[model samples]
Target: MQVNINGIETRYVLSNEGGGPWLTFIHQLGGDLSVWDQLAGYFRNDYTVLRYDLRGHGKTALSREAFGMADLSHDLASLLDALGAPTTHVVGMSMGGMIAQQFALDHPSRVDTLTLANTFGGTRPESRALWEQRAASVREGGMASLVPSTMDRWLTPDFQHAHPEAVEPIREVFGHTLSEGYAMACEAVRDFDVRSKLGTIRCPTLTVAGRHDTGTPPADTQAIADAIEGARFELLDAAHLAPIEQSHRFAALLETFLERPV
Candidate 1:
């Protein structure tokens, strides 16, 4: 469950049922590997699903020093090597997407395909203060205080009202998140900028966007698709956490795209 990787103890779950190409899933800022549990089960019959907690979230240890996207990306790479996986398909959402892009860019040969969903290549310059504000909020009120506003941003009101139970995991996981880890990661997400380098990623890529997601709007996701040659973009009828809100549809799209392209 935990491996000493890149000088940090990384917590991960590797699905046992599937033995095909490794399909690594990364969670958003506040979430851990469980963020992908639903999709991992869906793909476990065919693909080896590897999901893990980022250094500061879940049971994984926090970074020893101030970190960057590259540091986070390398954590994924090293974990795969430790697991003896030579290459893998990388799927990342939100903050995880930034790390995935960094992984694909920094270690192109190791990435079989890239799936960026409900994420952006970078935060706008004007949003720097906003990121700091979030960091402050978490530092002051902890994750519990962020649940309501975050839920509003992640899930639409209708979905929250219709299926309140579904969003509870996020609340629970997020509530328990380490403030230091959250703040460290928030700063990383805040200062992250990979837009100029998105063009360098040559792997088969798919970008998914939540049409109603204001956090990372359709335009932002489309820019990533536009930058990456031959990358495909799909718009889903959900909010920021599209995969959780529209799990079946997102899974169907991912399944179709990942089918051996021969």
Candidate 2:
């Protein structure tokens, strides 16, 4: 479905009718709501799962002006408000994690719990450079230049070898993504830095990382966990997109986190 939130048309997919608490899933760069497909079914029996494409990606409309992390954060807050979910357990990965952090910081009262997976707080210089380079490439050649490297960064060798079927959907999603939207999101990541404000997040937090994740390694996840007070950190034996690489374990971990009393 689509909704006009804060003047921009945002596209989202919702699974309602569950009796449990609300859970919102935010995908990383080069991803849409469908990125959460594997993980969403696991929570269908319990939580109301909401997934959406950030502006400039997937089915959402793109902004002509350059966007920052705050803009993406507000987009999410608006989506939640439109859905009548004032507060929810928010889960985000990679770039989505950055948005989730900002959302929690900006709207503390609207976030029940925070889960960040395979993400960073922007403490590394090299990672920032890499993101900038990616932005430059996308602006020059569009999403095609990003496909191969993105696949390498996101998938584990074993999973890629065992499940070739998984590659096509991601490829198609990338093929159809608006270059403008994808480039703008990359800029948001390049300019994003939330390390100094991590202390401001008051919601219960969980940080999950893939032990084999090269894009955003375990140390990046540790940095986020260390900054957030009493945040629980766990490492799964998967790659960057752990939720897709190890769906069963990832879903169980998320379920357990959401079920825990805050």
Candidate 3:
């Protein structure tokens, strides 16, 4: 289904199983709602699962006007309001994780729990430079030039070799991403600086790190977990795309966290 959120046409899917509260899945940079297909299907039988394409990816089209992470968070807020979801368990990875953090910060009462996977809270100088360079490359050479490097960073060589079929779709998603949209999304990450404000997050939080994820290392994820009061942290034996590479394991972890006593 689709809805107009903050003047942008947002595409989303909601699975109602009539059992539990809403669980919303947010994907990584250059990723669409489809990235959460496996995870959402895993939990759909027990929970109402929601997955939506971010502002500039998948079926969603980007506006010519400038927007930032906060704007993305507002879009989410509008989406939840449209769905009449009072509160939800938000699960996010990579850039989506950053958005989840911003969402929780901006709309504290709307988030029941926050699950961050293979993501960062803020940008370091080196990482900022790296993202800026990537944005430049995308603008100059287009998505094709970035696909090879993105695939290398997103999936380990062993996984890529063993799961070529699994990797192809993601590769195509990255390859087909609009350059303007990709560049703007990169700027959001490049300018994001929320490390100091993480302590203000009042929601129950689960921070996950992929052992082989070089894009957002364990140290970065660990810092986020440390900053949030009583946040749980775990490390999975996968690369950047842990939910895809280790679907069962990731689903199990989320189930255990979300189902635990409050």
Clash-forming residue pairs, model 1: none
Give per-model TM-scores. 0.97, 0.95, 0.97
Question: What is the per-residue lDDT of model 3 for residues 87-159, given as tens digits with 9 covering 90 to 100?
Answer: 9999999999999999999999999999998998899877788888888989998999878878988888989
For candidate 2, write residues 119-147 as lDDT tens digits: 99873665677777777888899888778
lDDT of 2: 0.86
Clashes of 2: 0
Model 1 C-alpha lDDT per residue in residues 1-262, reported as the tens digit of each score: 9999988988999995868889999999899888788899999989888999998899999888888898898888889999999999989998998999999999999999999999989989999899999999888878888887888999888898898788888878888989989989988888899899888888999999998998888889889999999999999999999988999999998898899421
lDDT of each: 0.90, 0.86, 0.89
Which one is best on lDDT? 1
lDDT of 3: 0.89
Off by over 4 Å in 3: none
lDDT of 1 at 24: 92
lDDT of 3 at 34: 83
What TM-score does model 1 achieve against the real structure? 0.97
**Candidate 1 or 2, higher lDDT?**
1
